[model samples]
Target: MSEIPRLSKERMNGWAADLLVCLRFCTRVPIPALSFEKSTPEISLAASAYMVPIAGALIGAAAAVILWLATRLGLPTSLAALVTMAALVALTGALHEDGLADFADALGGATQEQRLAIMKDSRIGTFGGLALVIAFLARVMSLAVLTEQSLGLAVTVLIAAAASSRSFALLPLYLLAPARTEGLGAATTDLNERLLTITGITTLVIGLLPLFAGASLARVLGALVVSAAATYGMVVLTRRLIQGQTGDVAGAVQQVAEIATYLVFTSRL
Candidate 1:
């Protein structure tokens, strides 16, 4: 009986540490120094996987608040959408954006070896520039459309997309082997299935929040299907292109999944 309480307390402490790790992994939010003294960043990442959707929701909420404030100040929907996107980029330090760019640049390479080399290069190529422009435009247009329909719709969808896309992005991390000896992919590949299940359920619940705000069930379901298909496509493409997964591939998955979800939300159907 004595040991049982101690074990429960220890489990709670581990969970708290994992939450901090998840936040630090996904956002630029500041945490206390004492938090780090008890946690190992890389090792704790997999344990904290279930909390990743929550972290993404936090990012989305921050951006959504900015969107709401800008619109309240009478900013044009388009401009407000742009500001919201800028805040998102700032919050995540453009981590996924950078990865998408690198992945795009790698697409121009003719061989696996060349592709990997291109991905490592810091320079942006024509393909990467085009990818960024097109992706940014699509996201802005989608948000602007939602804002025009209703602020509540826009906010709810944004939070849902941010949370679910990150959860879907983990599919590649789990389904494929790391492309290299060391990196984010290798570090996070060893996931706990029980935790992954928790992550998926948490994301699904958050993704369904738009329904409460009067979104059509078909629309939400369609968005989820599209996001899943998009993620699946990334998995196949990465396997064909590099024969394995990398951090950039995972980032690209998140980016595409996010856009796919937004597109479904804004569609006529």
Candidate 2:
């Protein structure tokens, strides 16, 4: 009994520490160091990967609240959806969006070396600008359509998409070698299958929430399938382009998967 209690406490402490680290990595949410620095053992980014869905859900919930407020204020559904997306971008510091831009710009390069160089440049290219505009339009339009149908469904889908997309983003980190010698992809090279499985299971629960909230089961499952396919396509493309994964590749996967998910959720056919 004593051993069981101790083990339970240790697991809880570890979980809290992991959640804090994940939130800090994925968003601009301020978490003071004093909160976890002294309370738990040092946790690696790979170890904290499993907590990403929780962090994503937190981000989505914040955006969902903004969506609710915007809609309630009598804003047009399209405008409200745009405002919600803007809040999502703000909360995440446009981290994934930046990745999508870099990835797009890299595609214009003729060689792997040139591609990597392009991704490293701070300035956006024409391709990058176009990619951002298209991605933003897809996301906002999908949310608007969903919002028009059922507010509750739209809210749940946002949370589910956010959580599942980030979970899928972890695929490249675990499945491919780093494209470079350093950076987030390299830092998380030790990401293991067990951690990914845990994350995937957590994401599944979140993804199903919309179904429980009266979303169509077939559409919800279809959304997940489409999202998974989108992430896989990104992984394959990244491997062919640069021979491995980068932080930008992971970010691109998230953005693409997110868009695919939203489109499926809003699809009528």
Candidate 3:
């Protein structure tokens, strides 16, 4: 009995640490640095990778709360949605958006080498700018449509998309490899086998729970199908273009998957 209690306590402590590390890396949520500043950044991030879904929940909840409050105050659904979207961007520091833009610029490059070089550049090109504009518009518009239908539905979509997309974002880390061995991708792709298993379990349970409670079975299934398909397409494209994935590629995957989630639900409604 004593040993079992000790083991449970240890697990709980580790879980908190993992969550803190993920929160630090994935958001601007004002987590104390003390919880994360002592560990090896690479190893800690890899260990916390599976908790991405939980981090997503935190992020999604913030947006949902903001949207709920805004609409409660008589703001139009469209404007409330844009505010929520803006809140999300601010929370994440536009981390994934930057990835989408960089990857879009890379898409215009003629060869794998050229693609990688372009992705590294800080400047946003025409393709990058256009991609950002289209994605942002689609996200905001889709969210507005969902919110107009029902605030409950809007909250469901936002939280569900955030968690599920991040869960799927784990694909590139586990699938191909880093396109270049010198950056963030290379460091994080080395996911622990046991940790990966745990993450997979959590991803399925956490990713599906919101949908099951807040949406229909069909919607749940559709989101799974669409996000999976988009993730596969991204993997294939990255494999062909850079011969592997990168941090930017991972970010792009998250954004695409999140948007795909919104589009799927909106299309049927």
Candidate 4:
């Protein structure tokens, strides 16, 4: 039998290290290097999902800053929003986009067995392509609207939307059991109450900090409110489809909520 891994060292490292693990797992962004030996420990990875939103916020801020600079350099709103969205996809290696595609493909599968199998296949399908197109267009168009308003507004929307979407993405994890006995859903069952509280508060505070910094209160609230609605939709879809959650469902939640946030921000309040 394989020797059981100990959480003793993992417990010792605490939040900072866990945050690093979250960064490494969630994105292609470069981070300060952790020591070589303990970089990919299962124990650390298991707990690190709690910090997914923190990673999302950092990634969102970076992409937003890039978009702001492009506009500052006189790029048109459409062009700047385009570049920013591309950067967003690259930063996370399109992690959430791929999930959106998988879940979309699952929609056409007609059975749980077929859907799960399609999700595992590397090729994209018709539904997956359409999902990506809609998701891409929604973000770019909504962001273009915000960019026309102001760079600060654009940045706030992106940061708040991305972070809050990511925060709620973990809901499927908390509410539904894993669909599989292996892979990310199975590996990430260690989100204890204290850890959940930490991430939830971190998501809230980080998501709301820009508001105190003078972001449009109504727009920010709109984004989060719509994101919550989107998350609920995802929960219902996932529970009804698979009776539980998978990594793809979690990713779809993030992307869907993100698009919903941007949509709300672009609406007339």
Among these predicted structures, which one has the highest lDDT?
2
Name the top TM-score candidate: 2
- Writing each residue's lDDT as its tens digit, candidate 3 over 1-269 gives 77999778667767777888788877877877554345423335787887888888878988999999999999998899889899999999998898999999999999999999999999999999998999899999999998888788888778878887887777887788788977768878668778777776776665565464467777777887889899999999889898988889988999999999889888865
**Superposed Cα deviation of residue 166, candidate 1 (Å):** 0.8
Question: What's the lDDT of the predicted structure labeled candidate 2?
Answer: 0.91
Q: lDDT for each of the candidates? A: 0.87, 0.91, 0.83, 0.81
Ranking by lDDT: 2, 1, 3, 4
On residues 1-269, what C-alpha lDDT tens digit does candidate 4 reach at each position? 23334455545455667678877877886776667435545445657767777777888899989998999899999999999999999998998899999999998888888888888787899999999999999999999998897777778778877778887888888788988897767767766677778777887776675575466766666667778888998999888888888888888999999888877767776
Greater TM-score among 1 and 4 belongs to 1
RMSD of each: 2.1, 1.2, 2.3, 5.5
lDDT of 3: 0.83
- Model 1's C-alpha root-mean-square deviation from the true structure amounts to 2.1
Assess candidate 4 and give its lDDT. 0.81
Give the range of the ten consecutive residues with the poorest summed lDDT in model 2. 31-40
Q: Which regions of candidate 1 fall more than 4 Å away from where they truly are?
A: 1-10, 35-43
Candidates in order, TM-scores: namely 0.93, 0.97, 0.92, 0.88
Looking at candidate 3, what is the lDDT of residue 195?
A: 72
- Show the colliding residue pairs in model 2: none
Q: What RMSD does model 3 have?
A: 2.3
- Clash totals, every prediction: 0, 0, 0, 0
